[model samples]
Target: MSQQDARIDAYIRKSASFAQPVLEHMRALVHKACPEVEETIKWGMPYFTYKGQLFCCFAAFKAHCSFIFWKGALMDDPDNIFQQRGENGMGQLGKITSLKDLPSDRTFIKYLKAAATLSTSDLPPATKKAAPVKKALEVPDWLLSAIKKNKKAWATFDAFSYSNKKEYVDWIVSAKTDATRDSRLADALTWMAEGKIRNWKYVK
Candidate 1:
């Protein structure tokens, strides 16, 4: 049987007065549509899980409440309910400040039920996702010159993984001052000469 989470109850109770009703309305439809859905808090907000994955989540902000179907990207948004990728927070319905800002109860139930159904489906393929691809890390000329000074360091660096090389590059470039950058480079070269990856302390 579907039931309310006391934590979710407390979350709504502590939210702003205006948001209380919106949260309550959404919460009711979630349970109504999917009696087996489970509710929990994730990233400081309420989320629903079905079929072992995050199905949807909601949050109360200072001026608005955000709601999202986590797998909405994979679902058929025939009503165009989802906004363009990366508009605000994780929510696709936009900022729901008032109950009127939300989609109608029937539409919401459709979304909730669809989300539950999606959790059991194969879902969207990773290639269709809108996420940006990471660019290849470039070795700065000055840092390259320093590494080349020691044959052992250069040889070790040449064989490092892209992520390992990025770690060294990022560490040196992220230094707040010239002295700090140079110090990091010197330490980085020394570690590399000994055939150590960046973040060697965490290596296990």
Candidate 2:
């Protein structure tokens, strides 16, 4: 039998009433699949290891719990089980709010065994290639002039990351009509001058 951690006991105990059963069930399933799996605390969550390699992990969040294979990104998920939602949405397994959100125990065991097997074997050789480098964003003259008018906004825009700056540029450039472009430009400048990103509303 795998050694269970006391910390995980407290973690499950402290979890929301709705999440305790889910966490306990996942821990049982992982042990069933790998009896020798060792338990430890990682990143402030419960993680399991087999032969010193990460086996799997589970975390309870404000609304959901995450139980994911450590080698998931490299695994072949034929069932398309990994469904990412937003920047952080319980990794590839989607939000595991309940047992219905996950596959059957046999399916999970299959994934775990495959990951354990892969850990003990060398992966297939791959042809390595360098990733393409992205170029700096080109700010339009009119937009630049508009931004320059607001000293604080110009400083903020210049200091913004490439993706952040690109959001404003893409919004203005993608406008279908000149009138629409002018309107978006005005809105973009107003938001930028206020030291806010284009997607500020979406940020937590």
Candidate 3:
């Protein structure tokens, strides 16, 4: 038997009048297609899990709703119901504003069963994203000389992390005009002397 969550009922009730029916219909299909599916909230939205793996989830926005399969990229989408990559909604069915926006009941249930099976199968692991490469920071000769003239600023800058130092160097180098560069460099030095980072105003 599938476990039904009361919060999901409340969630549907709280959704906009247009979205409530769409969400309720989607939820029912998920349960009907997978009798063993477990219901819970993840990331502030309703999710259906199977065999301790994420099967699918749905979200209700102000004007629309979306149903997303966890292994969407691996799913066999012969019907092309899945949205194109990088579209407005990352959901498989795109922005579902009404019941008509969804596929037929039979097609939707088939998708849910396929998703449930994939969740318990030995699916390939998701690829990991590589960490961004940090570029080297080069201090300008004039800027370096100016900082060196102030002992307090020099000491503060010397102890800064690579990111903190890069912030100042990038700000000075990105100036469009020589006067702007000089002005920013002067401000950098004054701030450093007071033991402040380049974006000190935003720091808590």
Highest TM-score: give the candidate number. 3
Error of 3 at 30 (Å): 0.5
- lDDT accuracy of residue 1 in candidate 1: 48
Question: How close is every model to the real structure, measured as TM-score?
Answer: 0.60, 0.60, 0.64
Worst 10 residues of 1 by lDDT: 121-130
Model 2 quality (TM-score): 0.60
How would you encode candidate 3's per-residue C-alpha lDDT over 1-204 as one tens digit per residue? 477899888888999999999998999899899988889998889999987888889989988899888877678887778775321244878888999999999999998999899878887534446797866678878888889999999999989988999999899989999999889988999999999999999989
Q: Best candidate per lDDT, number?
A: 3
Instruction: Estimate, for each residue in 28-127, the C-alpha lDDT of model 2 and write its tens digit.
Output: 9888898888899987888888887775788888788887666665677876667852213265577788878877889888877776666555553122
Enumerate clash totals for all models, in the order shown: 0, 1, 0
**Sort by TM-score, top down from the best:** 3, 1, 2
Model 1 lDDT tens row, 1-204: 486678999999999999999999988888888888888987788999886677888989889998887766666778877764332374778888999988888988898998888777775522344687766678888888888898999999988888888899999989999999989989999999999999889979
Instruction: Give me the overall lDDT of model 2.
Output: 0.79
Better of 2 and 3 by TM-score: 3
Model 2 residue runs over 4 Å out of place are 85-89, 121-204
Work out candidate 2's RMSD over C-alphas.
Answer: 10.3
Question: Model 3, clash count?
Answer: 0
Model 1, which residues run further than 4 Å from truth? 86-90, 124-204
